[model samples]
Each structure stands twice: as C-alpha cells, then as structure tokens.
Target: MPYIPLEDHLPGITGLLEYSKDTAAPIRELTQTLLRGPSTLTEGERELIATIVSHRNQCTFCVTAHTAAADILLGEEETSTKVKQDISTAPVSDKMKALLTIASLAQESGKSVTPESVQKAKDAGATDIEIHDTVLIAALFCLYNRYVDGLSTVTPTDPAFYKGLGERLKNNGYNRLPEGYEHLKK
Candidate 1:
C-alpha cells in the first residue's frame, strides 16, 4: 500500500537513501555510526529524542521501535511509567528534555526552534557537539517517520516486538532488517 509499488520498497531506510545512494549512503552510514557512537547524550537520551519525535509525527513504527530502544537502555523499572508519559517530563535528564524540546519544535515547525532553546541547552551543560547531534538526529527521524508512514506498512502495538528489537536497532540499525523483512520487499 505504499505510494510506490511493493517491489520498490527496499526495506529499512533504503528508499530515503536512494536519492543520494552515493552520498546519502555514506551520510546514513555516518549517522548510524553516530547513533551508537560516543557522545554527551547517553544512548537512552538519544533514544528519547527519537521516541519523542516519532510520537509527535505519529509514526507508529518509529515510536514503537524507539520506545523499545528506550526500554532496553533504561530498563523496565524506569521505562514502565514512561511508556504512558510525555517524553518532555519523562524520568530522564534535563538535557534530554531540552533535546526533546528542540526535536518537538523541529517536528511542529522547523523554524520554531528559537535561539533561546539552544541557549537553554547550552546553559544546561549540553556541549556544542551535543546540540548539533540532537538537531541532526531530529532531522533524520523526520525523514524516517515519513518513510514508515508513507509506506502504509503494518504496525503492531505489542511491546515485545520493540523489546526484542532494541539490541539490534541499537547496534546494527536499518542495515539489517528484522526477520522475514526481506520477503516484504518482494
């Protein structure tokens, strides 16, 4: 049910990378590296940014995936209540909320992110690199959210799917599709 034909679905973020396969592939490869790479933002903080943006965009696939990612990073005790809460005030660091603020603003209106927000993040001790990466992560997920929703792909609410997927998503990412996923492309 994608806007394009089924055969066109390359799975993962393949479609998004199609335009810049030569350039975009490297960017994506870099992004994936950054995803699991070292940064001031903890993996949980990064996952929270993704989950917040996913929820705002109403991208169920991303929401579920990142939610699971958050769960795996934070553990069941911390993530339990967060499952039903707004990410802004969820039991995460203040720096995380700032990133979510930036991400949510980016989602609602790209221009909505004010200098004040960036300053606030800075005041909160978020380094320049942290702020930069937060913006990149937000922007990337916007594309990812659209890709999933645009595809008309099936999305289930079961938490277990995400739970099991956290390790792989945190590690390999969109490169390795889930089991039986390759078949969907055909």
Candidate 2:
C-alpha cells in the first residue's frame, strides 16, 4: 500500500499526480516539453535519459514506464536495455553516448557532471541545447524517482499496464491524464 491514500487504479506517478492536480500541472507541462517538445533530441533519446536516471535511482515504476516509452519511440526494446546495462556498447550515435554520460553524471550529482563530459558531448556533435536538455532531463527524473519512491505509490507489475502507459505517453504527451482515468482526480 502507498504511504498515503492514492487511487489504486492509477499506479505510480499517475496516482501521485492525481492526488495533487495543482502540482501535477507544472510537472506535466515540464515533462511534456522536455520529452515531447520540439528539440534536436529524438523522443526516444529523451526517454532514454529518463530511463537511465530512473534505473540508477532504482525506481522501478519510472524505469519501466520510460523504458517502454523509449522502446516505442525507438522501435526497438533492446536499445533501452542495452543502455541501462552499458551506454558505451549501446548502438546509439556517439553524440548520444556522450550525452547519456553527462546524464548519468547528473544523476549521481549535479556537481559530478564534469567539464570533460560536456566537452565530449560537444566534440561528438551535441549542440548546447542537447547538452542542456540532457542534464535537465536527468535532474528532473531524479526528482521524479525520489517522489514516487518516497510516497510508496502503487507500482503495477503488469507489463500490459506499462505497454498501455507507453502508448498513452507516446500519443498523449503528458498534458493530462487520459480520459478514462479522470476518476483519479476526484
């Protein structure tokens, strides 16, 4: 059970967001902009940043949800898995590898992000915006991972639940909860 009362039907961050729509609004907007907004980074790449951070934090819900989203956007499940296991060997471009390195450092500690990492990303063709977004996405997911785990929110074990969530995230872009889930807001 969650540490606080949360809708059982709405697992993980969804329940938490519904528990507080006022707070959820800014979070949803930020998430939408970072993950789905126009940028040089592909949606898959952004989701990969989220996945790596959540995985490092050991937040199962966020990791699985974002892994699904990354898989869907990238059209391959292996890439996310590969990245979580080892970014160096993952089949992404050099720029992505370097950016993910920066993200990982940010996950550890904002201060851990060395100038060398930034330089590596730039050398690999990462624009300043890409580097900026990678670190921000990493920092954001760190907050999210802690929030969900801290609250002990419901974390569904079903793969089907995550699949549906991935589809919704891909199609809806996090502006609001899906239509059927409105009951959570009450």
TM-score for candidate 1, residues paired by index: 0.77
Model 1 clashing-pair count:
0
lDDT of 2 by residue, 37-80 (tens): 99999999999999999999999999999999999999999899
List the pairs of residues colliding in candidate 1. none
Question: Which 10 residues in a row give candidate 1 its minimum summed lDDT?
Answer: 6-15
Q: Best by TM-score, which number?
A: 2
Q: Name the 10 consecutive residues with the lowest summed lDDT in model 2.
A: 177-186
Q: How well is each residue in 1-186 modelled by candidate 1, as lDDT tens digits?
A: 455544353433444455335766666666566577777677777887787788888887778778777777777646524633775657766776777788788887778999999998888788889988888888888887887787665565566656666776766664534352455343
Error of 2 at 142 (Å): 0.6
Query: Could you tell me the TM-score of candidate 2?
Result: 0.96
Top-scoring candidate (lDDT): 2
* Global lDDT scores for all candidate models: 0.70, 0.92
